[model samples]
Target chain A: MKYHLILRVVTRLLVGPILLYGLYVQFHGDFGPGGGFQAGVIFAVAFILYGIVFGLRDLRNRFPDRVIHQLFALGVLIYAGTGFVSVFLGANFLDYNVLAEKGYEGQHLGIIAVELGVGIAVFAVMLAIYYAFAARPPRIDDKDW
Target chain B: MELAITLFLFCAIVATAIAITTIRSLFAVVMLSGVISLLSALLFVLMDAVDVAFTEAAVGAGISTVLMLGTIALTSRTQKDIKRNNLIPLAVIILTGLVLIDGTLDMPSFGAPDSPAQTHVGAAYIARTADEIHIPNIVTAVLASYRGYDTLGEVTVVFTAGLGVVLLLGGMGARSRKRRQEEEG
Candidate 1:
């Protein structure tokens, strides 16, 4: 990793754009061909790329495993929370009609909320897997490959 | 042009798969598998399933390949020679392939408007998306608003899987790693 100056520079340059694109996929999912799942994986890729180049120690310092664990649970909470909120609003479970004054608006709000939950959950899980892999010392070194 | 592209993509995918099987280097195999995923993603896009294509590209080509490479790093770089008979496995694969091919014959052709999928609740969902969800993408409306419960379950599954992995492989912090290195020294 220390020897690959060009790789390090390129990764640094690419990480920002990759993260921005992940956000675009996350929020633009309703109108476009992406959603929470794709966005979350893309986000994880961006961070993983940075982590691979910069080192796991650096990445873990910036984003701890504990926080990702919380975010992972939070996403499920958000999705289920949306459903329960609907139930409390005198509607059926997972019903979006009662979320807002207008039915369409409520649906829109509900979709956004749920998608956000999906995104957070997917991203955290993906990152956590990466952590599990990187936590162990690699048997093979970069030069060997 | 579409048909030509599709043919090319399919050929590329088949070629990559063959290469992957023949390759002795585990790294090359991983890279080839990634190539297959990318080619299939292109095919998905050609079939007008951009969402599916996106997921395939990200998860199949991106994440899985990286994770596989990580596995290779954890284990060994080269595939060890095991003198085992491949006849039974090959026969089983062929039989399964034939059954799957036969099954596909009964299904509606791709993009058939009169197909059950299009004729069934698909129409209802489409009609309702514009009226109730006001969203341009019927997929999002169906996934998040219409079939929200299913998606909740999917997210919960993702969460559970993450929890399980972490529980099994916990203590991935810098402090633990540093302590391990110190112990090694």
Candidate 2:
């Protein structure tokens, strides 16, 4: 059998579901218990699992650091941009009531946008931290364990 | 039954902490810390703080555990037995714990209807969430609409922290490394 046969198989089987679950937590935060922070961590966990199994090189190949850099700023921009948009619409900063015709609709839109920003920002940070730590050469080897 | 479960969780958490302190293996200590976080998450659930519970489970137990493991990989797995004066630190910890426990005596009992937290802006948030925001989850409404500025600030901090880590540990790219090597040649 291949090395870490069970782990690799399980990780492959679970990555898709984990990503889906993360999406569910992200989009469903308005109605459910979780919000952006939790969803972002869950999303990053999927890649983390893949990286642990397949190796960091493969993970980096799939998700280039350049993309991570762009996303790191993009999330915050989306959040602040929502506020600026509301301000331009003649409402106060982050005042989502002016986002749509109805106050509630605008609030809903704003929450989703802001939460999306949170989710993206958190995901990038978590993955970036992971990469920083994991990229280092380990003092201990597999046989040492 | 709820109290029983809470008591069990608390006891288990204390036991995990003791185990963590006694254990020389850094790997086991990291795992024990994750256990403490997971137990704390359960306690949050019992207190009806589902959102807090979710965060504790995901970030505290899940992500932090992975990060700690990465740290262990970079460093030694065994903790050094540094025989030093820990009495002062232990005394300070006990004093801090006692002071915190004393402080809690003045606070309202768990889930009391008349507690300051539930009676003040929390009450208003609950009452107006359906009207002003119309979101089913009041927590989301409070976090995103009522407390949008706070969350925006938090996101900015996360972004800044990530940028710092990238600057500190992450080399820009392989291309730069290759260019440097070519220059050296």
Clashing pairs in 1: none
**Candidate No. with top TM-score:** 2
What C-alpha lDDT does candidate 2 achieve relative to the native structure? 0.90
Range of the 10 consecutive residues with the lowest summed lDDT in candidate 2 chain A:
A1-10
Q: lDDT values of the candidates?
A: 0.89, 0.90
Docking model 1 quality class: high
Comparing only chain A of model 1 with the true chain A, what is the TM-score?
Answer: 0.97
TM-score, per-candidate, Cα-based: 0.93, 0.94
Least well predicted 10-residue stretch by lDDT in candidate 1 chain B: B168-177
- Candidate 1 runs further than 4 Å off: B171-185
Clashing pairs in 2: none
Give the share of true interchain contacts found in each model: 0.88, 0.87
lDDT of 2 at A105: 95
Q: Give per-residue CA lDDT, model 1, range B1-185, as digits (tens).
A: 88888989999999889788768899899989998999999999999888999999999999999999998999998888888899999999999999999999999986689998888898998787787788898888888987888888888888888878777766456667678789999
